[model samples]
Structures are given as C-alpha cells and as structure tokens.
Target: MMVTNLCTSPSSTITLRADEWVNITTIPNKPGTKYWVSAYVNVTGGTISLSMYGDISASQHVSYQITAVNAGAMSMTYSVVSGSPTVTVTSMLICTFAEYQANKTLLDSIEYFDGDTMPRA
Candidate 1:
C-alpha cells in the first residue's frame, strides 16, 4: 500500500493591510492519485473570506489551491492530505480494473481593488 500526506503550517496567519490577497498552491510528488484538502481561518474583529479548489479525495495525491479574501488584517491556512487507493487488493494478487485517472488543478486568487466596483451581472 502507498500513502502520502501533506499539510500547510500556520494553519492561520495574519495578512497585512497593504496585502491585497493571499494565494497558496501545492503540487504532489507522486503520480496520478486523489487527495483531501481543507482550510480554516481565524479573524478576530473583521470578517474573513476564503476560496479553495482541488481534489478532496483521500485515495491519492492531487494538486491543491487556496485563496483568502479579508476585510482587514487576518490569518488563514490551508491543508492537503493523501490516502491509500480506493480499490482493494486481494491476497491472490489478481488483476482488477478501475476507472481512468483524471488530472486535478486549481487556480490562484485574484484581488480586486476598489470595493465600490461591482461585478457584472
């Protein structure tokens, strides 16, 4: 059985006022596989906005991405972990078939200036 685990430290960190946004990305060292991803934030007075993408599966390794949008100085963190394959291997070592592997990818965050500017509907 093969397994891999990955995590992001500072699970929560402050973003300075000058900072527009926070972006994080992760690339697994292993081949095609699934991965589980999670994120949390700790903001005292102000509100914290968060966005995350990528495979959340525990069966294999996968690329992950996270972005945070905050009103003021705040802290946030994201994590990724991988687990064993979903398929079961028998003692006889008989060959079995499974679904084809698919690539997982995520996009980084993009900060927008001027809160007055509204998005197009």
Candidate 2:
C-alpha cells in the first residue's frame, strides 16, 4: 500500500538528463505481487524512452503505464532515445496493491485495479 510519488511542486516538473537513464525514487514492493506505475511527462528537445512504459515525443504531454516484478523499493526509469535534450517530467506514481484496496471506493473514481494478484486478500 506504499505509494512513492515523484514530483517537486504542484506547478513544477523534473528535468531528465540527456542521453542518460533516470530512475525516480523507489517504491515499496512485494514479491509475487503486481504494482501499477503511471506518469505524465513532457518530452521536449528529444524523444524520451521509458523502460517498458513507452516513449513520448517532443513537447508532448503523455501518460504511460508499466508493471513491476522486482520487489522491495523498485524504481522506474526513463531515457532520451534520440535528441540530446532533457525530458520534462510532470508527475508520476508508483502505486497499487494494498493502498488501492483500502481506498477502493474512494479511489475507484480515480483509477481501477484488477486486484487478482494485488495481495488484497
């Protein structure tokens, strides 16, 4: 149920280094469980590629998703695929599992989870 959200301020964003892979803060993980990852990024000055999440175009606002298999403080990474410019990361989330179950009704309006392998039981 631990959610590790990456962002500086409500109106600010993160800048990714050019030609390098960046891993935001890690999130809690449990083996044999499925976790959801979501992010809103602005890829400017280059094409940013994420690890298993997907890629974004220059000056685009994109939302991406990915699932994790690693346990204990897992991290999601992004890289610049083409241009030598950095990517602007708006908001990100490493959430799922317990938290979603506890807040099922409250969060249902926000996002939905299959919960089959979420460790809710």
Candidate 3:
C-alpha cells in the first residue's frame, strides 16, 4: 500500500494564495482502484476552510489537490485581514486491486478444507 500525508500549522491568521497549491501525487497509479485522501489542520483562534479534488476510497490509488482558507480572529476581525491560507494533508492510502487479490489468494490458501467444508481456525 502506498501512503501520503500532509500537515500544517498557522499562527494567528493566514490567507491562502492562488499560486499556492497543495498537491499529493505518485500514489499507486492503478486504474479502477480507489484511494483515501484526507486533510488536517492544527490552528488556534482562526477559522479555516478546506477544498480538495478526487474521491476518498480504499480500493485504488489517486491524487488530490487541496486548498485552505483562513478567517481573521476576533481582535483583528475588522482591522486585521487573513494572511495566505495554508493547507495540510493528514493521510492518504492507495489500495490496488492487485494487492487485494493477492491477499485474498493467500487467505484462501490458508484455510483448511475438511471433506466438503473448509474450516478456519
């Protein structure tokens, strides 16, 4: 399984810029598979918005694009403007069909067959 992770921390306030793009790539790169992508941010006294592309799945590998938006704090709500937004990806996983099939075959081979039924102990 291939995995990727991203994390971010912002002090006070920050705003995201257009040029700044958070990208996660080079997963398994398998077709018909699903991948899991997630984002996590640790910040205090600030509001943040997150956006990303691609669906979260565990059967395939995929890429994602994420963005973050920051809202100013109460003290600077009106006077202070949010700085560049920062985004952090928390976790990613690529589960390909080949891996799944291999696991299944291994499991099947491990089971003991008795007469007409197979028993797993």
Candidate 4:
C-alpha cells in the first residue's frame, strides 16, 4: 500500500504543445504488480492527454491503472490536441495495487438508497 509522488519537482509545472509528448517522470516498474497513476493538471486552450505504462488518460484530475509486466522504468508523458497550453502538474501519485483493492472493497460494502429502494448494483 505504498504511495509515491512521481513528479520530479512539486513546485514546478510543465507546459506542453500540440502533438508533442513531454516526459514528466519515470517510475520503477515491479513486475506482476499493479499501480494506479493519477495527476492534477490545469489545461488551457484545449484538453491534454496523459500516458503512462502504455495506458492513456485525459483532462484535469484523472487516474490510470496499469499492471507491470516487465522490470524497468515506466515513463509518464502529456500532450495536447490543439493549441499550445500552459499546464500545471500540481500533484502526481502512484498507488500500490493493495491500496486500490482495499478501496474497491470499501466501495463494494456501501449500499446506495434512492428514496425507497436501493439503486441497481
């Protein structure tokens, strides 16, 4: 259940351009393990795309889950689709698989009620 910050510097942000991928950071890959990667970014002009461990995500605060299949470094990158945008990578985190499973277990234990009967599961 270890949590790690993947950004190289916390006080700085990276600006990206259209059709260009900017490398944020590269994290260590533990084979057979799962990691949840999330980032806090501000996008101006257009939306931005994020990629890590071959998994892709987009916009603002988003998380991408991926499993480590080999040993090495897993790099995270970002790109915009339209005009050059100023982006602030406020926070980036990589959570362990156990933490994810634990959160899922907690979510599964909850029952949502919509007035009279509970909503469909």
Number of backbone-clashing residue pairs for each candidate, in the order shown: 3, 1, 10, 0
Candidate 1 lDDT over residue span 52-80, tens digit each:
33333322222223222332222223232
Candidate 3, number of clashes: 10
Ranking by lDDT: 4, 2, 3, 1
Q: Per-residue CA lDDT of candidate 3, range 28-63, in tens?
A: 233333322222232223333333332221222223
TM-scores, all candidates, are 0.24, 0.53, 0.26, 0.54
Error of 4 at 88 (Å): 3.1
Off by more than 4 A, model 4 = 1-27, 51-59, 104-121
The residue-by-residue lDDT of candidate 2 on 1-121, one tens digit each, is: 4343322232335566654544554344566665544445666566767666566775543434344556545444566667765566544444554554565465446543222223221
lDDT for each candidate structure:
0.23, 0.50, 0.27, 0.50
Return the number of clashes found in candidate 4.
Answer: 0
lDDT: the better of candidates 2 and 3: 2
User: Residue 66 deviation, candidate 2, in Å?
Assistant: 3.6
lDDT accuracy of residue 80 in candidate 3:
12
Report the Cα lDDT for residue 41, model 3: 31
The global Cα lDDT (0 to 1) of model 4 is 0.50
**RMSD (Å) of each candidate, 1 decimal:** 20.1, 7.3, 16.6, 10.1
The pairs that clash in candidate 2 are 1-99
Q: Which candidate, 1 or 3, would have the higher TM-score against the true structure?
A: 3
Off by over 4 Å in 1: 1-3, 8-35, 53-121
lDDT of 4 by residue, 34-77 (tens): 87655556666555555552222334555568787776654444
